[model samples]
Target: MPKRFQSVEARKLIQVSLKTNDLREARLLTGKMRADLHSEWEGRLNGSASPAAYPPDHLDMTLEATEAAYSRIRPKLENLAKQQELDNQQAYDAYLRKLRNTRDDFLRAKACKPLSVWSDLADRRISKNNWILPQGSEGYDTFVDMIAEAAIEAFNIEIARREGQFAAEPSSLVVKAGLKAKDDTAKDGETILDLFDRYAAQRLAEGRKREDGITQDRKVIDSFAKFVGPRKSIKGLTPADIRDWRDTLAALPPTYQKAKAYEGLSMRQAAAKAKAIGAKTISPVTVNKHLSTLSPFLGWCVTNAYADRNPCDGLFFGIVKGKNPRPPFSKGQLEKIFASSLFTGFLREGQEHKPGIQRADDWRYWIPIVCLFTGARVGEIAQLRIEDIQLDDGIPFLLIRHDESTGQRTKSGASRVCPIHSELKRIGFLSFVERQRSRANGKATCQLFPELEPNERGHIGAKPSRFWRDYLKRIGVKSGNDGLGAHSFRHTMADALRTAGYLDDEIEVALGHNQKTVTAGYGRVRQGTVKRINTMLEAITHSYISFSK
Candidate 1:
């Protein structure tokens, strides 16, 4: 019998029965069980490999639900007639007007009761407006008026109960309303905001652990909500509405544009204010991003039957031609960058020019330098644990992986190991690792760069990327139409490798890219293949490489 394994996540101890007495067979069985345990654990942490499709039962509307609601109102009206006391028709008319005004007050009130109460009030308002007053010869005038007001009061109370503003369970009237409700009438007619919440919740249930993506989605969706009015029904959304919103996004000023009066407003609100102030329009790429995020959200609406179709399905802003590709740092720019005060030390206003890496011991000096050779993402480098840098057969390698326990995630959710470039080794990279290890008493879990903490949104590399962007500005490396930034280091490496005659596969492997063809995915890269990649990485040496003491 093998030792039992307890799962903290499931709170259960797993026991395997090998059903064998032979020692060798039992050992083999135990090894297989351990391997299975590890695979299952990793799968759970990373999320399900394939999520089950949602059932379409949510779309069903039974025949009973489809009947006319007006027919059901007759009985309630008859019951109200039996309870009527007022006989003066003129006085009754005045009383009905008062009820109308009271219902209007509830509708326009700043704070509503619970949703159910509010919805019921809205239903009564509709019914009252449609109710014909019994004229000079007609009878039951007071009964009709009283029933309408009763419905309003009953609904207000239901809202308080459902919204958790009160302790009581739903009233008999509320249950009757529910029983008579159509799919379209239920849940206050499924507003766009309601669908957005459901979409976000479904994504979370599907094991989406990152909030950054959802936060971005909310920004786009919230702007749409503000445009359409929060209570607008999903059924009311049209292609025209989407087009109008798209145009609004296009005319909106860049998010970074600022005005003193709009300081505390949301990004969308600030953009609107800035636009009114005649600020410059945002880039087409940004407008496109808004549409792209919106497309999927609307698609989800369609899937869940909230909408007949996605309004944003076929819309796109045309990107202008000849935009400056984020070009690789020119050879001259690279030289100036490494030789700047950031590397060699320089002075500022009222301050001494502190020279060398020691004065700037954080990401300011190291992240870019590491990026220059390895072409690793600022995020991948920033979140690195000490163990991520390891010696494989006497060659140092950088391991980029997604570890949920450490709140570390990879862009593609795939892990890769790249050999440390020889240039990085010569520049005291190993020495820095040694110091970090000694400081932590040789603990491999220590961060390679402890100074860089995760940002408010929990992205470990977000602030570091900003720091690098500011550094670029300091060195006069403005991000132009070419889309150039820290990521251009990757393009620079790929270009250098191509110039050195490395195959595309070797470059792709070194850069942590997916092997393009089906054949490339058949098996693991040969050890000899890695040796070739390491050679290609070494060839990235510069015409102006200098990191001396």
Candidate 2:
């Protein structure tokens, strides 16, 4: 076994018998066995051993599946050859040169690090299928091998065709014509779902979308695909189809996707069930969210010539906004929240509601206060590193930015510097920062709230948000999803700033909202800008509740 294979668990190892007495046959069998072991070990090392982590398509390692995967990309190879033949002599020579360069690059990459090359091809397949594959799984490795084989076969065929010799059997003219006809048909014969996958991949690759956002958009699009029949082509999409989907979405119950009652049922079927049960359906706002995702997707399809026009155009004009918008925390609610056991006193770490002498200075204690003053989102505050707190020309400010290495992301992909409010400084926020720094002991990358771990979606704030919601209920300030929770603190800050006579742009800058005007991107937030924001923050007053209490 290789040194790499040593890391694999002993339980995963298998013993095989050649089951032959002949020496020559035994040698051949042993060699084949060795190769198989190596492939399996490589697959395990690459992280493909877990079947649960991959999509269903990835699990299929059959020869037929491999051939089908190859067939999907064969048209592009054939089209390249056809184009070279039609071009002028100079253009033809250029085409050959390009192919030679491409082949050389491919060969070099394969020879140096073959798995990476194979993995790249496998990624393309996964992207086309709209499935995410864990980089190193047995299934992914299998697909990589299959794709590599297909790609090699394709290169060989191209090489032979270039040499004016048909080394392998060629497709019949009838078959070729049928394939060409298929390609000529609607968007290279790709389904609406297929085009959506491509659009999603492009968006993700361009950093235009986040993984969480992509996951959400995928859910909406997948539901839409199911509603319209997954096999439906992009060209066949009509305004009527979109309207029908919107109507169906409005009729379905909230969280119908995860509800046990609606499990294994189609969208129409679930909606029908919801209607029969007289259950409360999703709001117009929720319906619009689905449309919002689809509208841009369809727009992309149209831009790419997959469709004639976006069917979702002007569809949102009909959706009336929901009446129950999230409102800011009331003055009385703020009083009760600050006076809660978590702040004044708590029995212990976990039991935050019970009255006791213990006053915890953790996320539960500080996150809300930081949000109340800075107007930063709960997630933003929750993900703050010790280094994020800094002083700019005697003005202490928070550097709110997306750090990909730390998995901290801003909502708008834009970073902002927000001056620490005077109230927070007066109440010992800076002292808290120093204490955290002391605890970190010069570790610049240490998180301010290290106790808060990221959830499955890589959101550090999710658990804290849940804790806030539960705390709100315990303190009788909120009940259920009554549109009042941690976010209300941000809303409260915005309202307070507005009441303090701050301009909209100034408040937006303080709150880290993505600037819409071109001039907003002129320069970095300087010391003067930080001072102005600090002055604006100081203007905010809550006379009803005293922090000194």
Candidate 3:
């Protein structure tokens, strides 16, 4: 034979719990697992030995398990009846009542327990109420009742007896199911464990509030399951799989009205309650969200020592690079930029702003206002909490942050607090805060402009793009370029500041860009620079209300 290559030992070394009876089977599973990968096991042969290795409780039984249990206890019940025959019939009846009471309590306690946990369904029963007297003369007769207080405690001890064996071998769950039993309950599809792990870590790292978002993650996972091969693993997600998912999601455009989402989703709805934006094409922002969700899952495995490397590090979006990433806004398009930002939306029937240019509690105006003044991303502005704001000496400021795979890590791996204006503060911001406090306990979020709709529950809906587009058209503005939106706020605000004589360093601080340098070091807020940030804010918010000659 040619030179032999020493194969790496694929057998994983593990500690077997003394509680398990299938140590030999577990070892065999380890040997087979040694082949090409070291990962989570899927099918039952892996460590979780099948019932074939051991017999199950009620290995053969009828569907009416409760009735079957009652029937089995009937003989013992009759023997007790015979022993009590000579006693006062009423006393015998009283004794039976106590037994029945004890039995009812046992059923009540164990009903919630999984059937597998109880191999013998004899645990469930109940009896009718009754009264009885002792066998002695009526004057000396003792009262007997159904109060089985001490007996219930004893019955509980007996119920605990099965746990030692049943917990050791859970194989009874499938075996008892008979023909209905499955080899495994986990479906053949992609899962989101790693995805949530990574994104959760990013949120924590960025110091952002972390909430478990199972619904959204499930939407992506269940849809991906149908298209992926059987028994698919998330770790084995292929580029083609991502490409197909993206194309499919792209084909099914979201609708303009959020209400339309309630009708139903499709055979492969990857996004939950994802309403279509009125725009004809999917914007770069929207596409990036899909990537953000999928890529981080792969990243989670790498950071957690699960994988040697992140598979997402090299994966590119789309065949066309420019098609995926959005370019930063440029100069010379200030008015069009403002117009796009001011978009009011399509003139749909009975669906326009309610007799006012803006919704009463809308974030559309405030969000753009923040962008116009601070040049920060929409997401950064959107995630602001009232507590996160700092104000002192007639000034308001924001703690600019980027929630990454972990919530705690701010952008640039650092947080910078930026200032705000007296005028902007005057624009009902505090009144909005008071309103939030009243509804704090009952809303998606108290102390934020984007209050969660009670009906939608935990979902966060974006401000409508229609109102912005229409408002922009009303303001005589057009995008200088074909593809652009609220992001233009950064470019417009930057240019306006440059014209007002702020240097590039000042502009970078205003935008909270992730640049490292001596000036950026000073980007840290000084004790009294709220005045400076306020000055910067006053510089931008002056002309939003339109003027006429």
lDDT tens digits, residues 1-549, model 2?
567788875645566776656554455446646786788877788887543343645223333234443455566777877866545777767776776676676666545655465676667656655555566777666566555555555565566676577656324332333334344334443776667656766776668887677777888888788777666677777899999998888899988888999999988999999999999988887788889999999999889987889989877746445654668998889998887788888898778988888888788888989888888899999988999998899999998878776788899786677889878888898888889989999786899998989887788999989999888898889987688878888888899989988877777877877788877668875323777778888888776776742
Give the candidate order by descending TM-score. Answer: 2, 1, 3
Q: Residue 95's C-alpha lDDT in candidate 3?
A: 64
Which ranges in model 1 have alpha carbons more than 4 Å from their true place?
1-186, 204-209, 256-260, 263-276, 321-325, 348-358, 479-482, 520-530
Quick one: RMSD of model 3? 22.6
TM-scores, each model vs. reference: 0.64, 0.64, 0.42
lDDT of 1 by residue, 269-357 (tens): 76577678887777778888888888888888888887788888777787877855656787887877787777776454212123433
Measured with C-alpha atoms, the lDDT of residue 207 in candidate 2 is 80
Q: Model 3: residues >4 Å from true position, as ranges?
A: 1-218, 234-292, 299-371, 374-461, 464-487, 515-528, 535-549
Question: What lDDT does each candidate get?
Answer: 0.64, 0.75, 0.46
At residue 353, give the lDDT of candidate 2.
88
Report the C-alpha displacement of residue 110, candidate 2, in angstroms.
Answer: 57
Q: Candidate 2: list runs displaced more than 4 Å.
A: 1-189, 321-324, 348-351, 479-481, 523-528
For model 2, the run of ten residues with the poorest summed lDDT:
169-178
**lDDT sort, best first:** 2, 1, 3
Q: Which pairs clash in the backbone of model 1? A: 117-159, 324-481, 324-482, 325-482, 326-482, 326-484, 346-353
